[model samples]
Target: MTFYDVTVPISNAMITWPSDPAVSITGTSLISRGDFCNLSELKIGSHCGTHIDAPSHFLENGRTIDQLALENLIGEATVFEFKNKENIDVSDIKQLRFDNVKRVLFKTVNSSYWKFSTFKKDFVYLTKDAAQYLVDKGIRLVGVDYLSVEKFESQLAETHHTLLRNDVIILEGLDLSNVERGRYELIALPLKIKDGDGSPARVVLKST
Candidate 1:
């Protein structure tokens, strides 16, 4: 019963998405301040660090974070690896071996970017066509090793729209650097934010 904690640690030092609010942490109370207990203040974007994007993130009148079922958040998942990919295209998606797989996590080279302070502009991401492929394949949940599943340069964010419109759950900002490409039991539960479009999550994997 070995478990892999695949979530990236959320901290003020962590790289954040451009234009999003920077993570901040400060001590509100400390022993040095003559306080009996230590207290801290925290502020972060809803989608910071490891997170889940709900359908409402892109689709209008779509379901929110609290509305998501636990069954979709926890399940048997396939971890697939891709090397030397600038962006995940339809061809890459077509190569996946599916056997009643409802959840899939892509371990890409983008995970290496986690070590840098600067946000990577060229992170490996899913193309709209590849997103469509997943929708067609009936994937209930899709995860990525980077901050977003869609390309950074995408103005329209068609990839996000395609998946969200199809009711596909998107898990992003995963740190898969330690996890190998194989089958694992996924236990990713997001913060229960009411009517939230997205929220941070604690994602873990159990080896079978």
Candidate 2:
């Protein structure tokens, strides 16, 4: 079996969404300093690094991270690569057959931004129409190669609203640059933060 680690490494220098809390790690205990073991303090946003967004991330009355279905986190997924497209629309999604596809991960120019030293605000993202299209097709999970599924400057928060409102799980900040478009078995497990709106996840894929 060939396993692909699709999660990005999290570090202090890793780019995070603008306005979100910056990631920080500080050593609190060290064997070099006469401590018995090594320990570090970590501070990061719930949406930091590779993470999942629960319905509560956008809907007040929706389920939180812990409430998400485990079946949705592991499934057969299809990877769709989009090129030269600034925004993913419903037409793009319509071109694929979603039957038996529980999860869909999109690889776009956003993967290129990960190579940069700083965050790029122009990552390709989903338009509201595309989000709605997925929901209508009964997609249970959606993953993107950037910090957000919606465009950075989305005026109406339409894309997020459409997916979150329908209980679709959103996985973000994936590092899909090294992978090709194909069917795969996805394993994306988020921290079980009780009643929390979101949580960081460790995602991997095995070629099918």
Candidate 3:
């Protein structure tokens, strides 16, 4: 059996969504600095790096990150490779075989942009119609390789609302460069932050 860690590394210099705060890690004590042990204060957005978005992220009175169940976060998942697409449209999504696939992760050109130091304004994202398509097919979870699942600067943000409103778990900022298109056991769990709209997650895939 082999395992793949699909989570991106989070650091103080990592690029973040323009609307979100930057990652910050400050040390209060360090063994190298004559302290008893190393202690650091961490400050970062709930959505930093590989994270899961609760419905509360885009919906009012929606479930929080703590409410996400382990069953939904860990299970069979399929990786879909999308190439030469500016954005994932309903037409493209309609062709996906949704049978018996509970979780879907898209590996797109956006994964290449992960090597950069700046946030990309044109990362591949899902269209509102495509988002609805997943909901229509009873998709329980959706994952993307970029910071957001929706298009950048979308006027309506329909992509996010449509999925979140329907209780679809949104996993974002994944590093799927090492994985191939196929079925695997997904293990992704976010921190149990009370009332958190989102939380950092460590996502991995295993083949048995």
lDDT per prediction?
A: 0.93, 0.92, 0.93
Candidate 2 has an lDDT of: 0.92
Q: Which 10 consecutive residues of model 1 have the lowest summed lDDT?
A: 92-101
Candidate 3 residue runs with Cα over 4 Å from true position? none
Clash count per candidate: 0, 0, 0
Q: Please identify model 2 stretches exceeding 4 Å from their true place.
A: none
- Candidates 2 and 3: which is better by lDDT? 3
Candidates by TM-score, descending order = 3, 2, 1
Instruction: Between candidates 1 and 2, name the one with more favorable lDDT.
Output: 1
lDDT of 3 by residue, 42-75 (tens): 9999999889999999888999999987888999
lDDT of 1 by residue, 78-184 (tens): 99999999989999889888888999999999888899989999999999999998998889999999999998868999999999988899999999999999999
**Structural similarity to truth (TM-score) of each candidate:** 0.97, 0.97, 0.98
Question: Ten-residue segment with the worst summed lDDT in candidate 3?
Answer: 150-159
Predicted candidate 2 versus true structure: per-residue lDDT over 1-208, tens digit per residue: 8999999888999888888999999889999999999999999999998999999998989999999999999989999999999888888989988878879999998888888988888888898889998988889999999999988877888888999999999999999988999899999999999999999999999998
Candidate 3's error at 47, in angstroms? 0.9
Candidate 3 TM-score to native: 0.98
